[model samples]
Target: MSTVQAAIGLGSNLGDPISQLQAALQRLQAHDAISLTATSSFYRSAPQGDAEQPDYVNACALIETTLAPHALLAALQAIERDLGKIKRGHWQAREIDLDLLLYGDAVIQSDDLTVPHPWLHKRDFVLVPLAEIAPDWMVPGKGSVSEMLAQLPDHFIQERL
Candidate 1:
């Protein structure tokens, strides 16, 4: 199978988030279908919703994968589930969250997935770390990663780890 360069956003806010992300990275590196390329330093950020929740540990990863989009999403979901992620609701605190931020510049919309994640532009947690590793990556209808990072609102709370 041919490989396509892909990007992923990783975040966690519950149950030793830093370790969870580190373990996720290790699992991805061990996956036969995925090649770990670049990874950004972890960042601590305030939760976007439900201000009552603890801050999140966020980062982005660049990979080369042979898995089809849906298959890749399934792989990510599997990893999340293995790491004890519970789907309580959108933006809810979880042990781990893995998002397929971009998939070889493909724009896909379906009942199960969306590439170039719908809110990729609006979240600094993802963009800031993405810029560190893949600043030149072009978002399908949007600008380069760094350029998009420059355009986002400055209200988010982010601290590198």
Candidate 2:
């Protein structure tokens, strides 16, 4: 199968977040259908929804993969499950969170997933790390990653890894 470029967002707030992210990256690299390429510097950001929860460590990864979009999503989800992710609640703290941020330039909408990550433009945690690795890549309906990062308010502070 032909390989396609894709980006994945990784976040963790529970336990040792940095270690969780590092192990997750290793898992991605171990997958036969996925070739882990570039990874952005890890960023520590305040949790978005519930201020009471712990801050999250975030990063983005660029990969070359032979898996299709849904398949890729499934693989990411599996990685989360293996890493002890438990869905406590929406925007709640978790062991690991993996999001399929983009699949090449393909636009997709379905019951299970959305490409360009639906909220990539609004979340600095995702955008900052993404822009670090792929500043020029466009987000389909949105503009470039750097452009989207420019439009958002500077409320979210992210410390580089």
Please report, as a residue range, the 10-residue window in candidate 1 with the lowest summed lDDT: 152-161
lDDT of 2: 0.94
TM-score of each: 0.98, 0.97
Q: Write the per-residue lDDT of candidate 1 for residues 1-161, one digit (tens) a residue.
A: 89999999999999899999999999999999999999999999999778889899999999999999999999999999999998989888889999999999899999999998999998999999999999998998998999999999854646789
lDDT for model 1 comes to 0.93
- Candidate lDDT (C-alpha), each: 0.93, 0.94
- Give the runs in model 1 whose Cα sits over 4 Å from its true position: none
Give the winner by lDDT. Answer: 2
User: Mind sharing the TM-score for model 2?
Assistant: 0.97
lDDT of 2 by residue, 81-125 (tens): 999999998899999999999999999999999998998999999
After superposition, candidate 2 runs with Cα above 4 Å error: none
